[model samples]
Target: MNNIVPIPLSIGNTPIRKCDFLSEYFKTNIFVKDEFHNPGMSSKDRPAYFMIQDAIQRNRIQAGGTFVEASSGNTGLGIALIARQLGYKVKIFVSKSCSQEKIDKLEEAGASIELCDNSNGLQDFQSTQFRAQSFAAKEQNAYFTNQYYNTQNIRAHYRTTGPEIWEQTDGQITHFLCGIGTGGTISGVGRFLKEQAKAIRIWGVEPRGSILQHYLKHRTAPNAVRPFDAIEGIGRNFVPGSFDPQPIDQIFQVEKDVSIDMAQWYYQHTDIRCGFSSAAVLASLKCYSAAMRFHSDDNVLLFFPDHGSRYLSKLYAENSKVSTSNAHSLNG
Candidate 1:
């Protein structure tokens, strides 16, 4: 809806509302920034818009030109959505491990798909990211909007999302919880909030197999790391260039089963239809709630990255046994 930016599509300024059920249990406010309101129905829309607009402004790309990016799912869809709006062509090199629904959505958005080798759902051997970069370089007039390394990714969230949250909470937010993917969301928003008030805690959630948690603890990646393909797009084997570790307070490593179970609970019980990685943040809250300092009046906000609809096949499939009988509970 930006006239000056040449994008007439609706994006950003999503709602921040309290999760009434979760708030009652925690004895404090639990707010979720619903990024589904974006034109692409995901938080990725913010950066996608910014990066594309930036490329256009710099004359690195032109109308009707091909726009390329390597994404797990949502980011590709964001670019694809915007590219179509601006009469640009999109080619996405996505992860082979991503859900079928994501692949279908990308095609629907007019993005040509290239499924790259994501060895066991983690980065390995000329990954999707590198493929996009190489292809963009070789292709005529093609620009690779690399979300992993793009500073515009962080700038998008910092300039818009962070300010929105701060204003929405009236600067009373005590904790900000988010899943660390490319590290842009948490890093950007966390830095902005910290600049405003250093007391505001920024907590990142990482899937069990991700190297980010290990990297944070020891300042180095493990020699051998396990692959976590259960959930798409929330963890990284190698730390991304966009990830600024200085703004992050701490990170919690979560399990795939628990994350999926939490997303399932939201689908069946709550009004919020959270994706796998968003549920990872919720699971982190459940697991680490006791350790955090929670006061009655504190506002704890969650950055819900996307809706659960795109994950129906993976998280809520008939054969998927990720959920236990007591999967819904915050208690162990």
Candidate 2:
């Protein structure tokens, strides 16, 4: 008989494949974890599964209740996937700035949606999250699964993503590259990798508009001190509670066009189509990896956050031109 056992989910434990384009560009063996293959079409599935499962065990939530939260896109999909499977209701609050495709997908999944107005010059998701919190507090049998502050978000990456990378690479991973959104994914994964091996370098990639890169560079920056970036799911207007700066070796600020180009490159180069932030991460990996002279003894790993399906309007617009309107300045 075969020793392979049945797995519960087809999404995670995704392929960590070597990137041909990136490897040629970087002159190093660069690998991308195809997180877009996840059920929710993003890496959020990892944390969302653990978050919901742990919430159930800890009695933080009960069945048939409403799971209320704010999301740029992917996290909402993750929660909706579990909510539908477990017979719960999900209400997602999204900023008006999020892509239209994301809004449609959440609704298609039977998630109730509230669109927040960012026309008043208020920061994007912060306004939405605030509204969501208020709504969750007033609603009956509602639980707010705050992805940003939730400790389970961090734990998810630590237990699953980090160990998986270490195992898949046969402990040869010298550098880990990813974009910081809620801070959960990178923080958890970086912390775990550092604990397993002290020499591992964890580098976080953020959009140029985000403060994370500036924070890493100057330990602080004006305006950017608040997590403000345009890329969905990977940049924050505020620092998440779960993010720890200690384990990070460096930060790279990626331009929107660079990310857009890389995302387009993915579709052209590989069968896999990934989100904007995923492209940003890979582009950053290419740039960073190329600078380093590594032998077969070294390894560089990059994470592809979500699928490109959610970003068709922005990244794969009808015209050949990709929009750069979302790009903001970190120094401002």
Candidate 3:
């Protein structure tokens, strides 16, 4: 009998497609890393797979073991899908602020859900992370994939995502941009790109309420951080241990309304359905283009972390309250 391969094993090698519309509109070459093509439908699949595999290899977890984590949405979905495929039980402690679509997806993936009240703040122990940690501590044969602090998160992207981008762009990528979450994507990809070509500029995008902008500017975490904005999968009240700001050349702060409107516009115009965080990067790209004149030869790459399907209740909802005037002012 042949050994069965889990579906989650087929996670990486997502496609990088050139954005003809964006390129012509911006008057420069622009490419998008379509992470939505991943089996888990998000870039979170990369790190989640790596972390789980590493845990298994190190005997930290075994078959039929329990996997636990705290996430806003995408990461939990990735882990849940992978765990289900590998016959592991998954318990996700997610923020109550996460979209209904995401919660539904997680439940459909056969993962037990624990909704954490994030109205106060996400960084506190009373938040999702605390609940996840406490659950893992009490459960037998349970492994907590602490994505934020896990070095494996960065290593996953460095070994896979970074190399894939380097090869896909034929080592000619000039600028790489993405929204910062656990900082794994930017840090890992940035390190690899810079190692290959020192001139490659790595830009980190953050929401207005995120502490990353303040941290990047002041070289320290802020004293009093605000609640995480409506945008999910990116931004944090506190910097994660996995985050490495050293390779980032600059950080751009985008507003929640701007991200939502930009995402909707991108979907309408280019037919590329990206989530709010990805749109934040797009908005930042526009801001960056306005400030800096790009040569025709310059190649800019942006990572679209997840698809817009998971944002139906927020970014794509019919009753969603997005400011058209503000979006036009930014894009116009």
Candidate 4:
């Protein structure tokens, strides 16, 4: 008799689903890299898994070591899932702005959660990151999986995500769209696609309040902190070290209400629930369709980084004040 063991979780390829609704609406071919199919239920699994494995190879993390990180939500969940399985103690310092559902999910995954005030905005390094850094510094055998600044974050996408998209699209993708948080997904994937096809246009999506759009347009960082926007996982008040703005051909800024509305619209039409950032990308595509002059033959690829279940308390709340029709009108 042959003995078999179960395959480990978090080791598989996620599928790319065609966005038929969006394709018909926009009159262009569109597809979604459905990253929610990942074991951690988000795209962060790719980088988190690779970063941890790289650290182990470098002897920076070993058995019984502690893993610490600062995350809004998804990255922390990814790290916790991998670290706990690998015999490491996981601690996540997260901003209070993160949904309670995410905090509860992290705790359910056996990670200790420390909530930090995000009211001061991203420029104030004393927010969540400083606290996480301080905790990692005190631990004798701790590894900080600093997703924002870690070069491995970019490398992981470059190695895995970029190739997956290229192969899935058969090198026919003309426009690559994604929301930028740590910027690894856009920078790495953009570099790969641009290398393969010079004419491929890479567009980075951000919430209206984020400084990235301004920074890209004016080539200067904002001096004042923008108003708090409810959308998470994409916009940043400060530029992260992993972010390489050079590969991005253009940046699109979407309003918070529009993101929320589009998220709801996607669920209603396609039954594929996505987070705010995913909707932001869709909304941006709709808003820019006229100017970009997308053709029916153009193959547009959008990255949906996480599932909507993680955002039940915020974007998917039952008592959301904004209506879908109003949001569509704003975008239209």
Q: Tell me how far the alpha carbon of residue 1 in candidate 2 is from the true structure, in angstroms, after superposition.
A: 38
**Residue lDDT tens for model 2, 1-332:** 22221223554787798877767655667788878778877888887777777666666666688887778878898889876778889998887888999999899989998888631112443476777778888988778888877898999899988898989998889888888877888889999999989998888888776766666666654462443446666665456676777788888877776777667655655656678788788667645554555655457788888778888888777533323442222101
Is candidate 1 or 3 superior in lDDT?
1
* Residue 279 of model 1, lDDT score: 87
Clash count per candidate: 0, 3, 0, 0
Off by over 4 Å in 2: 1-11, 118-126, 217-229, 286-297, 319-332
Off by over 4 Å in 4: 1-8, 119-125, 319-332
Q: Using lDDT as the measure, what is the rank order of every candidate, best first?
A: 1, 3, 4, 2
lDDT of 1 by residue, 241-291 (tens): 888888888999888877877776666657556788898987887777888
**What's model 1's lDDT at 320?**
38
Pairing residues by index, what is the TM-score of model 3? Answer: 0.92
Candidates 1 and 2 compared: the better one by lDDT is 1
* Residues forming the 10-long window of minimal summed lDDT in candidate 2: 323-332
User: In order, what lDDT does every prediction score?
Assistant: 0.84, 0.75, 0.83, 0.82
For residues 1-332, write the lDDT of model 3, one tens digit per residue. 22333445578889999999889878889999989888778999888887887777778876799999988878888899887788899999988788898899899989899988862333477788878888899999999998888898999899999999999999999999899988899989998888998999899998878888787778898998767666787888888888888788888888787687787777767766688789899878666677756788889998999888888878877734335655566457
TM-score of each: 0.92, 0.85, 0.92, 0.91
lDDT of 4 by residue, 157-234 (tens): 888898889998889889999999888999989888888988999999998888887777777778896664657888
- Model 4 scores a TM of 0.91
